[model samples]
Target chain A: MRIIDVHTHPVFMRRGLQRTEIDWLVAHGRALGIERMVTLGDVLLHGRFPTGEQISAINDVTAQVQSWYPDYFVSFCFLNPTLGERHVMSEVERCVTKYGFKGLKLEICNNASDACMKPVMEAARRWNLVVLQHSWSMTNIKQRSFHTDPADTALLARRHPDVKIIMAHLTGCGVRGVLEAKGLPNLYIDTSGGLPDEGLIEYAVEHLGVDHVLYGSDLPGRAATVAIQRVVGARLTPAERKKILYDNSARLLQLN
Target chain B: MLCDVNAFLGSWPFSIVPEYSAPQLADYLAQSGIRRAVVSHLGAVFQPDPMLANRKLLAAVRRTPALAPLPIVNPLLANWREQLTELGANAAVRAVRILPNYHNYALKSRRLDPFMDALAEAKLKLVLTARLEDERHRYFALRVKGVPCKAIAAFLARFPDHHILCTGVPLFDIQNLAEKHANFSSDLSYAENITMMEMLRDKIAPSRLMFGTFAPLVSARAQAAKLTQSPLTAQERKLIYAENARRFFSL
Candidate 1:
């Protein structure tokens, strides 16, 4: 099966930066039938809140890795939205003009529904970039103030209907997350994080159409074979599997 | 062929996982290259008396040779001796599993001393499950945590002669305990990572590592691919996939 991993950290915690390490990751991913990988920067390198320079350093690492294997890896600009419009705008513009970043990556810098995210979504619209937000179920974790819950992502999608958003971690989002993202046309969910729970992929496809679900491994934390087989092994038709495994992401990220 | 050491035959109460019958589970696992599995019934986890569920497990897998029943026992219960006596009578049963967190008993409890002795005398292998579901995403009301690594270390030290198979342990715990104890083996059901085999190469031997699919609850294909797709030699792969399980359980 042809696959596109929509979320990854090839340079996690400042590791995997060597030329040899980058080549091994490409070979490893290609051996599993992965055609392209969206490289999100080493997101928690400086803890939950990172300074502007720190954010640039992280994105620079992603750019450096993508430069080594440009045809194999895709780059995403990691942004901490709480740094206000000046910083967010400057960083997003720098990444877009300098590195050709295709998407904006938001971690636990702030909740998606918070007022600080206004400029982040605004930048996504101006730059014509898709927004990939770090999201999980906040039922057990009480960090909703800064952490983006699936419901908060849905709210962000509703508020900014013009911008497309990809919510990360289906297993972390659970059953309620699917329902929360049911009718939002601008919102998408990626299969990543935690263990691969049975029936969750089917549940997501049932609630949100097959076109809205994306495949991601959150790698170095999860394996590509495991993530691919979760969708491969789901009870979906060949056409649906084709869409989830490769076609949907290819279309959404304009890889075709 | 892969012999999963952690496949389940009953439903998880909190999720939409398939609760497979013996033959159904066997076929489900077979799709992922798992030809044989050491099976346990989830019904035994919550019921006040586990024998009812244990009896069901014994009968259900009686005709299914691909599956071998691993009954769960609650030593804290008064009739644990009788439970062991009855389970030991069945030749199909090669091991007995215990969930200390779910059964409300600590690993250091005085009750397990006699229970360990009974297991030693009976010659049935012991399987310790550290956690069934991830504690963070488990049912909101179920407030149980995984058995601590320190507790497992103490138990291994306490019974220095017995060899135990531990399921659902994370990679870090497996490494932590491996440095101190040599009497335990861990399943890769929960030890997930991109280069998992490479990470374990320095810390643990292939004989101490085994394949496991937390099936029906977790995806068997996903868990199997974690091992089958990892970087391991043919010999190391054989040891992890089936040979180690055969020598460990005498299958």
Candidate 2:
């Protein structure tokens, strides 16, 4: 089965940044049938609120990985919207024009519902790039001020219907997250983070449909084989499994 | 033939996972290549009297040969000896499980010393559950945390003669506990990383690691694949998948 992981941080905590490490990761992923991976950059290396230069350094690492294995990786430009519109727009433009980043990666710099997201979403709309937001339930974690809850991501999608959005971490989002993403056609949930809780993939598919559920592994922190198996191991038809593992991501990112 | 050491029967109120009958659970596990499982009742985790849940669990799996019943014993209960006696009387029962966090007792509590002695005298194995669900995703009202690693390490030291099997232990904790203590074995229900089994094999012997799915709360197939798709030697795979569990439980 051909698989495309929609979320991964190949260069985590300064690891996997070298050519040798990248080669090992690419080979490891391919061995488990991953045809391609979306490199979300070291989004947290500089902490939650990184300066503009720090953000560029992180994106540069992602660009370097894409440079080595252009065929194997799809780069996403990591952004901290709290850096404001001028910083956000310029970084998006730089990543897209120079590095050919395919999407925008948002971590816990600010809530998805904040007013600062306006320019960030505008850059995505202007560039026709997908936006992947880091999200969790926030019911217990209680860092909703900066952490993007599933409800907050859902609201982001609701506000900007034209911009494509991917809510990362299906297990972290749980049942409430699925319902928050129920009606919004623009929002997608990545099956990444937390334990591969039983019946969650099935539950997501049941509520949001297979098209809205994409395969992801939050890799380096998670196993690509385990993440792929979470979808394959589900009690879904082979066709549904194929969509999540391959086709849905292909369609979302316009990958051939 | 994978023998899951961490499988559960009944519903978890926080999850939407379907409640399975013993036959149904057996069939579900069989579909994912789990030949046999050591299962405990989920009802016991929340109930005031675990014996009521234990009786229901015994009755549930009595007819299913594929599942070996592991009854949950609340050691803090005044009638824990009675619980152990009744569970020991059953020829099919191999081990008794304890949920220290949910049962509102610390692993270091003196209550467990006598309880461990009873298990030792009864010739029954002890299955200590570190956690059943991820605390980050649990219900807001359920504030219970996983059994602490220090408490677990202390417990291992306290019971030097007994070999304890711990379920739902994280990967890092497994490494820490394995380095300091040799008296404990763990199931890979909650242990995960890019090369999870390979990493664990480097830290702990393959013989000390057993396969567990934490099913009905976590996916059986996904948890099994944590080993099945891992870069493990055929010997390592054999030990973790069945041999270790068989020897641990004497199944």
Candidate 3:
């Protein structure tokens, strides 16, 4: 099966950044039938709220990974929207122009519903870039102050209907998250993060349609084999599996 | 062939996880390359007495050969001996599973001492389920946490002779137990990491690890893919896939 991982960090917390390590990841991913990987920078290296320079350094490492294996990896610009609109706009423009970043990655810098996200959404609109937001169910984590729950992400999509958004982590978001992203045509979900719980992939496809779901591995933190297998093993039809595994991500990112 | 150490037969009260009958579950496992499984009834999870549900599981899987009935036994109940007696007599039960968090008993409780003795005497294995469902996304009203690590350590220290099989233990918790105790083996039902088999091999031996998909609740293909496509050797793969379970459960 051809695969495209929509979420990943080739350089994770000072690990997997070396040339040999990067090559190992590329070769390993290629062997697992992964055609391409979207490299989201190590967003947690400096903890939740990173400085502008730190965010740039994170994106630089992501760019480096892409440069090393241009055919295998796609870079995404990591931004902390809490750093105001100027920082968000400048970084998005720099990464897109300098590194050819295809998407904007949002970590837990601030909740997706906060006013700070306005600048982030504006950058996405101006650049015509898909926004990949890190989200999870907030019932247990209790970090809603900075964390973006699935509902918060849905609200962001509802507010900005023009910009395409890919909500990361289907397992973490659970069944309710799929339903929340149901009606929004501009919103999509990636099947990454947490344990590959049964029935969740099929549940998402049933509620949100096959085209709205994308494949992701959250690599370095998660295994490519397990993440891809989750989609492969879902109770989905052949066409649905094909969309989640390859076509949907290819079409979403406009990957050649 | 994969032997699913963790699977259920009835509907979970709070989950959208599909409930399957014995034959249906067998077919599901077959699609995931699982030839056999040890299954319990979800009805036993919430019912005041697990005996009714246990009997139901026994009757349901009677003709289904692929699914071996592993009934949940609540030692905290007053009629513990009768429950054990009934399970031992009718079903070809090799092991009895216990959910401490669901049954409202700590692993360190005094009652488990006799319960352990009874299992040893009965020649039935014990499967300690640390957690059935992830605590975070569960129903808000179901306020139960996993059995504590220290309690599991104490339980292992308490019963050195019984080689317990622990299901749903996290990867970190498995490492913690391996650091202190050597009397138990664990299933990789809830354990996950980037290079899981590589990391586990560095910390613990292959003999102590077994394949578990937590079927119907966890994706069997995802869990199996972890082993099927792992970087581990053929020998290590055999251990995780079936040989270890065969030796551990004497299947």
DockQ values per model = 0.72, 0.70, 0.65
What docking tier does model 2 reach?
medium
Choose the strongest candidate by DockQ.
1
How high is the DockQ of candidate 2?
Answer: 0.70
- Per-candidate Cα lDDT values, in order, are 0.91, 0.91, 0.88
Misplaced by over 4 Å in model 1 are A13-15
Q: Which ten residues in a row have the lowest lDDT in candidate 1 chain A?
A: A11-20
> Model 2 over residues A1-256: C-alpha lDDT tens digits?
9999999999962244688888889998899899999999998888989999999999999999999999999999999999999999999999999989999999999999999999999999999999999999888898999998999999999999999999999999999999999989999999999888878899999999999999999988788877887888898999999999999999999989
Q: For candidate 3, lDDT tens digit of each residue in A1-256?
A: 8888899888862255799888888888889888999999888989998999999999998888899998888888999998999999999999999989998999899999999999899999999899999999998889999999999999999999999999999988998889889999999999988888888888899899899999998877678888988888887899999999899999999996
Cα lDDT of model 1 by residue, B123-237, tens digit: 9889999999777666778888899999999999999988999999998899888778899899989988887887788798899988997897899998898887777899899
Backbone clash pairs for candidate 1 read none
| Pairs with steric clashes in candidate 3 | A198-B219
Query: TM-scores, in order shown?
Result: 0.98, 0.97, 0.96
Chain A of candidate 2 compared with the true chain A, TM-score: 0.98
lDDT of model 2 at residue A140? 85
Ranking by DockQ: 1, 2, 3
lDDT per residue (tens digit) for residues B1-251 in model 2: 89999999988887788789999999988988999999999999999999888899999999999999999999999999999999999998889999999999988899888888889899999999999888886788999999999999999999989999999899999999998889989999888888676567668998899999888678788877888788789898889999998888888
Tens digit per residue, CA lDDT, model 3, B139-246: 768889999888889999999998889999998899889877788899998887767776788677888889888788788888888888887888787787888777
State the TM-score of candidate 1 restricted to chain B. Answer: 0.98
lDDT of 3 at A100: 92
* TM-scores for chain B, listed for all candidates: 0.98, 0.98, 0.96
